[model samples]
Target: MIRINAIPLIASRTFLPRLPRTVRQYTSYNVAVAGLTESQEEFRNVVHDFAQKEIAPRAEEIDKTNHLPEDIFPKLGEMGLLGVTVPEKWGGLGLGYLEHTIAMEELSRASASIALSYGAHSNLMVNQLNRWGTDDQKSEYLPKLLSGEHIGSLAMSEPNAGSDVVSMRTKAELKGGKWILNGSKCWITNAPVSSTFLIYAKSDTSVAPSKGMTAFLVERGFKGFEVGEKLDKFGMRGSPTAELFFDNVEIPEENVLGQVGKGASVLMSGLDLERLVLSGGPLGIMQAALNLTLDYTHERKQFGKKIGTFQLIQGKLADVYTKLSASRSYVYAVARACDAGKVSRQDCAGAILYSSDRAVEVAMEAQQCLGGNGYINDYPAGRLLRDSRLYTVGAGTQEIRRMLIGRGFNELATAEDIRAYNDATINGGVRGLFYGIGLSLPTHYILNSRVTAYRNLPSPAKAFGFVMLIVPCMTITAEKSGEAFTRSQYEGVAKRELDKEAQIEHERWQSLSSVQKLGDWARRHKYGLVGASWVGSLGVAWALVNRNKHQTTSQKVVQARMWAQGLTVGLLMASALLTGFDSSKTEDPRTPHEDHTWRAILESDPHLNEEERKRLHEIKRAVVDRKEQLVKEASNSVSK
Candidate 1:
């Protein structure tokens, strides 16, 4: 046998080891999970290592056999992952939704199917128990479920009630001392293996589902309860979804998860958290796709050069990176909101809506990058693509999400104010007249400049910005009329016009963040300040032009004085306009326009009647909601 000098051959000039250390280091890429706290990042790293060593090795086998990895549940329990959001006192890790999200992302990156089953157990069942279970109920089921001694799942969707969960046919009737559950839940994750199940059923058919439904904790050993045949799925096969049959299953009164006739609350609340956490699975799929593409692009060659070097390939990869980054950022921000107890229904929907769609696209692109290899089962890229497709149709379809988001924004619009911030006489009547005369001119000039910047904005945003610009001019005319002028009278006509324009533009201003809305309003109004200055400058120029034509020395002196005052106001407006260049600037040295926080806007008119006060309160609430939206968007940007 010839040794062939293997060591020397490996260390030859053409080998990578023979390359300069700096060259090697510079060529390597560094990728890290974004938007995570120190502890979260550490947890993610640990989970990544665990998934790579244990889950990835078994993923192929699990998929081939279509088996749920029952052994992994105990291991997850040992890692304090089974009860991620459960309180420590209840035999859990006492972590938040954000941490749970991190674990989900890392695990799903290796095996999406396994992660699907894990999500069904940890979030759908365990977290719901923690959120609504009575003390005795918690003590009875939580320990076993959290310790992996018992598997858990949730049953909500039925054959005809997937997106419209309220239309479910499942029912629980009170008979004697026990409640009897009838009807079946289909497409339930972990159904075949779950030892504990949180089931939703209608207790009162007379009332609407929003009020008549109730949640119950059902044990697998219950007399009439049975797991139906395991579902044969095209993707996420190892999760082992099945139909659950409840043939007069018996439940004690104490088994009710939340108040009777109020199961909708429990269901809705859990759905929000469910959306946030399940988002991590799609995020992980995107990440896995990106990772695989990166490696393949570096190694695969075409035309004697790496295929990744081509602009088209680079473009595809860049898009994948951007999508993954944005999705991760948005999901994490929503998870943080869930932890802080400041979550919004629309945001929960938005997070899943955005991430799920992007993940599918990113997975497809990843497979595309691999050419023929990605189409084959030998590579995991095909599997990632298959798994990612589930998000668009699962956990409420994209259509449902769109309608919910639109409805939420429309509600906010119904409550929003349609008038200028403040409209009142200043320095008695003289100053108000001067403001009316000069503000419109400078306002026009400033507004003209802003047109280009807002041109690309959504039609609603553009219309809003336009209406905002003209409000100050309208207010000036109203205030100039003094006590005889009611801002409401002028506002009536202006608002009608604004509403018409908004309608024509199809503007959904309510969708904008509070900061964004404020910015647009301010930018539009700043032109008034500019108009004031331009009016002065134009006046001075006119006076100077006709200076020699003055009939008397006094008139000449008066013209000179007019020119001087115009110079001052003109200079003031110019400096103000200069500062206005940055639309984000919320502070102004001369006026309170920049300082118009939602609180300040609310306080601008505190002496209103009851009806006005209520309207103002609604407006204030809209502002608060927008601010939260701004925070979430900002966090997403920073994370990216």
Candidate 2:
């Protein structure tokens, strides 16, 4: 049998060709297998073997008893799975997110409940501490937690705060150099078993909810700290979840995780990675379900033949396989992106959202393939189905995920529009500045006007003029409104011209390959382009100066116009150095029409009294009527 280190040697010539020579010397052929490098695949294999041999055997018992084995964490620690993403100096494996994801997937494949608890301990607690904890905090907490001598958990969700965590009621007040925490956290995973807890509370409620919060490291042994009864969960039964009570719990100032009043930043820093890692849980469940179904299908008989041979069973099997493959690919891809420090919030949410939904469907399909056996607890399919459902609700609900993804896309579009509008305003300001300068040169030097006359005006008049001139130049509203009005007056002519030009530009852009397009964009905006324009402008200016000495009156007038044109063009080119040009369409800044639906109105102002609601409805009706009347009047005018 080949050892783990020897994997690269066997396929060095064939599989290592695509990789860099340095990387190929160190990497393995598994890069081509499942997007894993040698080290990642090797780590995955080790975790998988340990999980299948140890945890898989106890999964059923853990589910039935609603308790994970006492020795489970220690075993995991021994395997270096607890700190898969932590540095080796902290008694961890010093691996990256992909390796951590693989470890989670393999453990979850054995027992999802155990995996849930593990994720809470390793990621929600340990990883967060590693990131935000002070050196002393890390030194104090990391060793025991990593060694499995103590469990860790993060407490953010309170009784009234889940998705809206900022609205949490837990409060912490500093009194005489000690923080007094008085509040409770509910639905906290591993709360019943954890030794160290990362707790967030409102440290200064006078400020905004998000800004006033603080995170503290609380020990289970702290005074007045209590863990309430373990929750009776329908799924993930073995994961010990409970409410935590803090009553006059005193914490030292050094115990503050990160800075006080910056808990939101600490909380947000880990959410994307948290979502990416926990996504592996659903993926593992899907794989487990598929595996159980495939085995049962091959062995179990129906209609005098193996059920796997039947077309319907084969179709179900194929669907499960396809979903598992797709979900795994997405999870792995996201994990790799996270490791590369290129995380996307929407993609992170999307990965969990898509995988969790697909996992539920796949789990149900797995049970369906088992026919009668699937519905019973003995088959493990029922448990898989139950476990799979939790993912949609946990780590923010699927509804929250969908909303986040939608908001992310909306923000992206809005940002692009804002960027384009800013670019247009800057370009317009540059043109105005150059034109003002060009006009000023002739007015100040040639006309010989007295500058002191304007300066002698009253201070108020000068201030008023400055405000009027600057406000219009600084704002985009006036410029965009003017452009819109001009287009409206010559609508047909402008539309035809714009459409023709747009079509030609679109065709030209589409004809270029992606690489060519990038290169073309680079060439257009390069410093060399600006330098060439400056050189040409200088050449024209020199020629105009030379010709002016020998020119007739009309020729001199033409030379002045040429100087103005050349100066304007040169300044425009120089402006390119200051800002990027965006050709993207800018959105109009008009307010959108109000929602007329009752649900919309209720959501917008949920606390509205009956009288207020009636008044709002009446106002809405009047607005709608006025809009319709305007439309009718416009139509009549057009007809006339």
- Candidate 1: which stretches are off by over 4 Å? 1-33, 412-640
- Note the residue pairs that clash in candidate 1: 441-531, 442-530, 442-531, 443-527, 443-531, 460-507, 514-626
- Write one digit per residue (lDDT tens) for candidate 2, span 351-429: 9999999999999998888666566676688889999999999988999989889997665246565665556656666
Among these predicted structures, which one has the highest lDDT? Answer: 2
Inter-residue clash pairs, candidate 2: none
Cα deviation at 465, candidate 1, in Å, is 35
Q: After superposing candidate 2 on the true structure, give the runs of residues whose Cα lies further than 4 Å from its correct spot.
A: 1-33, 412-640
Lowest lDDT 10-residue stretch of candidate 2: 3-12
Return the TM-score for candidate 2, rounded to 2 decimals. Answer: 0.63
RMSD of 1: 22.0
